[model samples]
Target: MSDHDPRPDASALPWSCEAEQSVLGALLVDNAAYDRAADLLRRQDFFDTRHGDIWDAISRLVLAMKPADVVTVFDALPEAKREEIGGLAYLGQLAACVPSAANLRRYAEIVRERAMQRALMQTADEALEVARGEGSFEEKSDRIGSLFATVRETGQRSKPLFVGDLMAQRVDHYNALAQGTVTPGISTGIPGLDEALGGGMWPGKVIVLAARPGVGKTSLAQQILLHGAEAGHTGLLLSQEMERTELVDRAVANLGSIGYSRLLNGKLSNPEWQRLGPAVDRLAALPFAIDDQAALTLHDIRTKAFAIKGLRLLAIDYVQLCAAPKGAPRNHTRNDVLTEISRGIKALAKDLGLTVLLLSQLNRDVEKRSSPEPTLADLRESGAIEQDADVIAFLWRVREYESHRLIACSLPKNRQAKPGAKLGLDFEGHYQRWRDSAEKVGHTGSVGGSADLGFN
Candidate 1:
């Protein structure tokens, strides 16, 4: 390429003209090296467009099953391109300089490395220019993520696909499953419930747990987060509704089987006091964290997730409560705002390969219905969660006996398993937890319990 080309100065940007030349020469000397070079280097990886052009011409001839020596490659180029790159004589010079094809792959590696550096530099400059314009942190942060995403996405190139190669991988995967080298997914520690979930909360999946105000949805979500943490997986609870103290106390109650009230009011019974210390120590040791920021935007949650070193699971307390990001359209309704947030969160979960346990608030109609059962339609504020989530499990307080209410866990919409099955869990309000119950549906009592989240 001409020296006056608009690209940045060679010294300022990362690129190796000599390495690019060596790569071209290696291919011309030994056609067998072209296969390895094609796998590693794209035309854009060449610093000088002239070198890139020569590589492209050689690639076409090699793929066409024609010999790509200096002569045939020189004749392959158009007249204008030939004049632009110093003519057939320049190709001859390149072929004469390289002694052998021994260093072809190494030269290709240098070309690819320099190309990545240039891409990163371009991304930084674009991000800086966008930041100079007016925007909130959320907007600017999202813009920078998009810019880097462009660089991170690789262009697809045609290559060989062998089924024998794939079958070998599948056999290894099956062996791993059989040998317990990997559990099916993140297990819930609840036997029947885990069975209903087809093993557990899966990676790259969104599970929505929706309920009305008094149903202990937050407590249940907290239970799952702790379960994951106990299994050595890192987790985060990003709650917009609950305070950090309430979350921790709920965790303590679930772990210690202590009354949630006692933990809140510092009035523990004697036996409860005995169980508290070990539970506290265990909870302290688990790889779990909570963010109870009052007005957390979607952007804030994403930043927090990325910052955690090895985050595998995240629980957003109740979807309707997250703040609308700045610069939302002025005329958007609450549904519109929630729809946008739900869409954004689903994208975030997939982008990060997170196993998201998203708590949702059911519509007021859930309380008014005669059967008192929740459904996908009861998902409040946004239909987007129902559409985006991989699983939709509903929770409700069903009064089958006067002594206590049974928390019915219904899997009405599971993408990976058979849905429409229910699990009856005895809600231990004293400890703010749920344990599996096999209570028959017809058992009767003077059913009564307040829909009070304070129990959690």
Candidate 2:
């Protein structure tokens, strides 16, 4: 009792921030401190995974973001815990400081936008739950309305075409080309194919080279990859069915004037190795990247493509193997998935302004029919693929198993050129290469021999 006083103050001890919290605690001291803390954390640029996750969530909340589209974003917190978040309150306070719109019409428009988002999500949920079951006419009508509104809003926000911007972009293109910043799109060294492809692969187009199994689709694609890299353009090949080393083996076999099977089986002799070493070195040094990831989705491909700076071309081998994004409508058949994937690939070409080569599989109808040629209808999965692609090439090797190499390519749909034009060729199985046959006739484009391409 000697030291005890009737009135005691508890302010002597330092006030500790909340347990297991950083952002909230900062706001607890001063309601406006959350922004400074978030900004500081962002500037720090935490690279650790654990800290990254926390900071990402905090950063979103600091901006008063609605965590509705992504469900797992804020799923861990309870209502009480969210309420305890002083940072959220601070965000609310900051939001209040913004010039509150005096016009009710503008406010109503903003509210309507949020409502439309909710309505779209609701329609998506219903579509998923029903599993293509027929609903009442009224319910179906409402869902259609919601979908239409979402589509309209999205389309309206898309980039509008302008002549000024178009001209400026072209000027930038010529400038880049003059400065040696441009990379050749399709320098396959086959002058005929190169010319037909419009100075190599044109940007903002998807060219699908489709064939049946056991054909030379993969081989021809790999040839293009090496050629592109050697010509100073970055090329990414996503080979879902083959391994990375196997891809390298194909490239070396094609470039070094050797057999692919010989290289794979380690049957190359000292003399063969001597010839292969320089070719391999040159290929390894080229601006080429390969991902042998199996079962990749469209999104996975997009992520990898996005990393290539000044990317000239992206090739996806065999579309059917690639999966679509999860959580899509359950009623969406494989055709729907294919349509979405093709559209996505086309969008990538438009966004990156690079050529996209999408390898596709032909339907069994090609095998059943006596015509012995693949048509646009033979494209596996979706018709949308044919519609979306700027150029659709059908590859047909009359005798895939026969030793004499012959691969026939026909442009079924070329938006810029005459359609149904055949580009005939001979394939070299040992070197895994394609070339203009001595028998090539009526093709008016340029021509180059395989020997002239340094493949000897």
Which model scores highest in TM-score? 1
List the global CA lDDT of all models: 0.81, 0.63
**Per-prediction count of colliding residue pairs?**
2, 0
Stretches of candidate 1 off by over 4 Å are 1-8, 22-43, 55-79, 92-110, 130-142, 149-163, 294-298, 328-351, 381-383, 400-404, 440-456
What's the alpha carbon RMSD for model 1?
Answer: 4.1
Q: lDDT tens digits, residues 152-257, model 1?
A: 6553244687888789888888899899998778987677778889878888888998887777788777888898999999999998888898788888988998
RMSD of each: 4.1, 14.7
Report the Cα lDDT for residue 153, model 1: 50
Q: What is the lDDT of residue 281 in candidate 1?
A: 100
TM-score of predicted structure 1: 0.82
Model 2 — TM-score against the truth? 0.60
